[model samples]
Target: MSGSSKKPMRRAVVPVSKTLPTDPQDQHSSSEEVDPIFFTPSPSPPSNTPTPDNASALPCDHATGEPHRHPNPTRHPDFWFHDGSIILQVESKLFKIHQTILANHSEVFAGLFDVPPPLPTGTTEGDDMVLEGCRIVVLHGDTEKDFESLLRAVYNPSYFDDTLPPSADVETLLDFISGILHLSTKYLIRNLRQRCINLFTSKFPATFDEYTAKSTPQPSYSSTRSSSHKQERYRSDTLMRALHLAHSCNITTSLPYLYYCTARLSLHRLLKPRPTDVDWQTKSVVLAGRERLRYATLAISYSFLLVFERAPTCAEMRCGFASGPGREWRSIVLGGESGIGSAPTPPTAATSITNAGGVNGISASATAERKSKSSSNRAPNPLRLYTRWPELGVCDRCVEWNKGVHERGRREVWERLPGMFELEGWDELRKAQGS
Candidate 1:
């Protein structure tokens, strides 16, 4: 009976009135403003005594009426945050930040917060006290802009989130990363510091070939490919900064690769004293890198010429190649002309081969000469030979042979790169980085 005959009861709804705060001018009535748990007021007025005109005063110091204390001059214009509760005045600029957040990320800050209260005389057991306000701290010696950059990274949620915002520009991105690394090192934030190093390494690879490989074409199966898919190339300054940062931070794994790329810069740029603080590439490293490259270049040049000299005489049936006179390969590189000068040639046919005895001697002499040349030019770069081989008027068989040599030479150079720079092999570097 209850199921069949009972009518459903309807709940009544009540409407409540909403009003603004008592003051009509109060626009922030709906949201609560964050207030500090503790506040330390400024000190009492100073007595009328002649203060020095150049006496430095803290930014937060508001002592009214003295021997006329000058107003504290402003220093950092870019980092002044109106809403920051803890005022960290670095130079002339005041940086308002949350102490708990800073303490969470840095041991130095945590230690600062853990300090016991000052004595009645405004001294902390022989340590100098900061300004009157408990929240106002003074910093000296470090660049204010760098400190600002560190704060931005700490407060910005994008870096900590899974989705990172696109970097506005390479230089800006580099400065941000560098700032983070510098502060992280100072504060002992190992995880954050390592993350900055990783980002830098990913952009500026350790090997010359790896840097080139970043631009290598990727196969796209999609029907609709756009220009946006291509990334902008990093500038030369960015590379220099990466190298400098690597050296400053003791990132040994990135050194050889960075040195290789820097050596590729023109002699003038590489040899010049670093133009600015940011351009921190070490002169000594560049010198060593250049010396190694010079030796490699000379070896390659000699190898190319040796290969050209030892190639067999033309066989007419196999392929069409210029023969007889006026078809020799021209030298295009440094030391290419003097290449075979270092190589010894066998005695001429008229001077030696009088009969069977002379014939065998001539064959052995030629063999010895070729062996000496090959040994002298042991550091070969086959790729350079392949590029210049077309001008040599060689046959298809010879071209293919040179191509194989070029590929082998490239592989050898890459494998020996770490040793050339006097560092551990690539595998060891990667292992140390926990890659």
Candidate 2:
């Protein structure tokens, strides 16, 4: 639909001025020049201007008056034939679709049909308009596979189900939903866009409070591995694509969370060059998101330092594990025992902050307090000190006290995520819809 034209359809504006600059340099002195300013031709565009590298050349058949017939015009199995009366083509694939059904769901299609077909007087049939022998519309600027996904959704009454089918793999469902988003957006289908957004937001949720309350935290190694694998289930490239779609479609609610999830990936993984197509704008967003995440993680670390600094010290000798010194607990929180060496020795006088640890592996450890160094090589999380606190080595009173601190600290950081990342408030973000 979009193509370059040698001559613009709209008339070009030509200026007619009565006055001219009096300065010698600005004036044309030649008598034959007609005072120069009275009649000035517009400058021609530079002949050497580079064409966009990303722009695809239109098929030669298009200019030669040859109909670009599809090589594989066979209809898809599930979507091929039904009670449909209209035909739509996406490149090689031809789809039999119902006009009324699509018109009802999409304002764009409805508006298209609202225009009376160019028929002879008294020669028109009912409301449905058939062109030549059939109502055919050829779609450009999208892949057949994407259109098929959208048509499948548009035709099926139960496509936007509240629950996913048991046979559906979560990742596959997400990809299809993303496809719906792409096509729906291109076609101006609001209902399908909203459905896709709702489903995607639910799948990759922003907060873990609802989930964490029910499931107990696993040990560090297993928890970290599980979180990594879960992230792997949906490839990073897919998430990046969805993020680009959200921005293009004005799906603001998904932006903050998508950005955060993308930022969570390690630099090596995030920076890995992929063959997949990505626009420059989306790539810029990802780079900026990395910086935003760093700032937020640093802020959370500072919060941990502040909380640990003010915590009441246990002077009683009966206090187990932590009886060595009040400062010992602070050391453990800042990775003093984790062998990261980033934390200040005297945690109370700490002036700098460190990186936040893994997302799902937050925990505390009293055994870590006793150990000269951590056994694992993972970066330490301040909240983990309280969540996975070695209860075996800690006194009952200290364990209970640590539990309250851990919960409060983790929740505080969670609440601060938006502010830390410079995103809109969580509540407002959740309510946003695609335009």
Candidate 3:
């Protein structure tokens, strides 16, 4: 959403891509992002540009089914096109396509319940990065606290007070967990988490991590059941989770507890009047600048566990280009690996590092973006994001990331971060943590 997310790149230590050597004159300018010789558009393109806002550009796919993938990977970026395409130019390649379309068609379910009014249908503001889903008003300050509040407001009793007829609550909950069907709760949580995670990861990876780690720890639940008839008691016990995730699914036993449990924890703090994380204002920027619907999986859970994996530049540590060679230093910036001879910056600081906005040290990102745009050189058509998804959830991105990190030796790399996975209160946990 903010910093262009990079793929785990691998190549020889030689200069892979060329950058227009910072002109001494241009270099005098106080910014890092290199300006394109021909500036066709900007993220903050003015309201007057011929930006399209066709609601149909939004994809309506579900998180459960085979996630909609661009039929033509040769067509666009991972996201579906909602309004227009982001045109990127790298050397000779160009690609363009709408990357944030939702094909789920299940948003109608939100209509059945009370959703905050649909975002302005035809607004000209979105080509930037993230989508301002049905809620278009620009919010101000304290994103985390405000975001938490939004979660709570959404759980308003009226929203969930509607009782379903006698149906299998367990099946509905399972579908919600596995994302096999459309329920407002399932859609909102998955979409919101996906959207928020993406935007924060790209723009503010550190802040995202802080938010994720600090959002709220899920409540402990005793899943042990003495008998199957404990349904009524069980639901009553977990009412907190349900209110937080009013997805209107048939509630049941095997919902993995984490499904509703995690969301409840997040929303409880969200609904509060004045959360500690709040400052003067409230704002939640959906996955970088992409809209609520235009999401791309960057890492899966297993991958996420390996926090030490670094992007290309940091991974190899400034492999100085000897010819026109610039000063380079070997660094390990992730998971507290600040000690690898040279200090490597984490992805979170990417914005600050590239204030003027350069690709965050990875060459493939620019290439991928440019390649995606070139494909759309012709007069374009409405685009879509995914084809079909599974009930399994799109945590695949994190899983993929773990695979990359494991290959790099996660524990050794993570040693850089100060207390990465170090368990706390060893003395106390040792007293109780059972070796």
Candidate 4:
């Protein structure tokens, strides 16, 4: 529900402040397991600020009484991201540091963005927008040496943010990732809602396929006519960057579904069939379908988590299709959305009234019943991937993360199995849930 504006992103103390404490480096740390944070669908930030471009007219939607569709500074330009196009802008030293990291981790970045996410193809790093922002206040000069020093400071892996005592320990990074994941999921949610609602009223695609029509990678994309290039893909390097940030904070989440949905909604443009399109019995069977086994071979620990927990919120959110919310609730353990809470709050049966002659007390799953009923009556297809991760479903590719990050060789103490993915306090989280 973030307000629609020129910008798709908004800066706030909300997530960053909330996330600073969860940076556990890995979930095995001895710190107490902090509870999980659920998702909150706040309306997009208000786009009340008038741009010089709109000086001629008032910013109002006469029909809906909403703001006009204008870009918000908070959001990166859609042109740089959507359609068969690419964007490579380097305005400041911050871009230099980002380029350094991007260069060092290009493979991973490629996997995340699903395209050659803009390389340092722009002018000097001094000209990058992100870097320029930093230079104005923090870095000052746009030299590599100065930027490197700043890079050392920003991702210091130490407890200090810009001289002031670090507002967070290293765990803040993980929260950053979680926040991004939430945003990515949020992006899917809001966009999909708009699409579904529009399609329902008028069966046409909601904005053109941003991916198919354009790309913003540094290098141009593969020739559009190549048959070999048909593996249409979607992976937001931006979203992945957020995922990495969240990992730095020791928060855990699912990339499989995020990637899958991004690939579908962002790339291929065809969503999987929804449960609402059919009936519940068939939906339940579809959920427990053979596809579940596709992820069984990733990593041992991940397999365990997958098997025990199953896909919870992500599955529910990824596709409107879900196998009864009740079953989903039992399997879910954490999230940042209303339906997806951090830890499962044990349901308590209560004494209450009922319809007609039945004066029975409220049943334990009364909440679930209400959810299903309400969702059933709704008139649109739901987009839940951007809302929940594992809760929705995991893809075949990322299933390997759970057993450990490095399956190929030896790992340092800090690089232990749990260390790589940034879920340092799993022991704490596990204990918190009395698992």
Q: Could you tell me the C-alpha RMSD of candidate 1 in Å? A: 20.0
Ranking by TM-score: 2, 1, 4, 3
Model 4: residue 347 alpha-carbon error in angstroms = 18
> Candidate 1's C-alpha lDDT?
0.47
The TM-score that candidate 1 achieves is 0.52
Candidate 1 ranges beyond 4 A from true positions: 1-87, 117-136, 159-172, 207-212, 215-241, 271-274, 277-284, 294-412, 422-435
Off by more than 4 A, model 4: 1-151, 154-241, 244-371, 375-435
Write down the lDDT of every candidate, Cα atoms only: 0.47, 0.47, 0.25, 0.27
TM-score of each: 0.52, 0.57, 0.15, 0.18
Count of steric clashes across candidates, in order: 5, 11, 81, 86
lDDT (C-alpha) at residue 428 in model 3: 28
Clashes of 1: 5
* Evaluation by TM-score, superior candidate among 1 and 4: 1
By lDDT, the better pick of 1 and 4 is 1
Q: Quantify how close model 2 is to the true structure by its C-alpha RMSD in Å.
A: 14.9
RMSD of each: 20.0, 14.9, 28.8, 25.7
Name the lDDT value of residue 305 in candidate 4: 31
lDDT of 4: 0.27
Instruction: Output the worst ten-in-a-row residue range by lDDT, candidate 2.
Output: 51-60
Candidate 2 residues 77-164, lDDT tens each? Answer: 6765566655565676656667788888875566444433334321223322232233444454568888877887877768666346
lDDT tens per residue, model 4, 1-435: 345633332111122222223333332332544433221111222345442222212222223445434322121232222232222211221122343333233322222223222323211222111212221111111233332333333345341234433233223433322333232222222322222222221111112132223222333256563233222232233334433432333223222222222222221112234322322332333233212211121122122332323233233332323222223333332221322212222331221214211333465346535544443222110112122335534442333332232222111211232322233333533332120
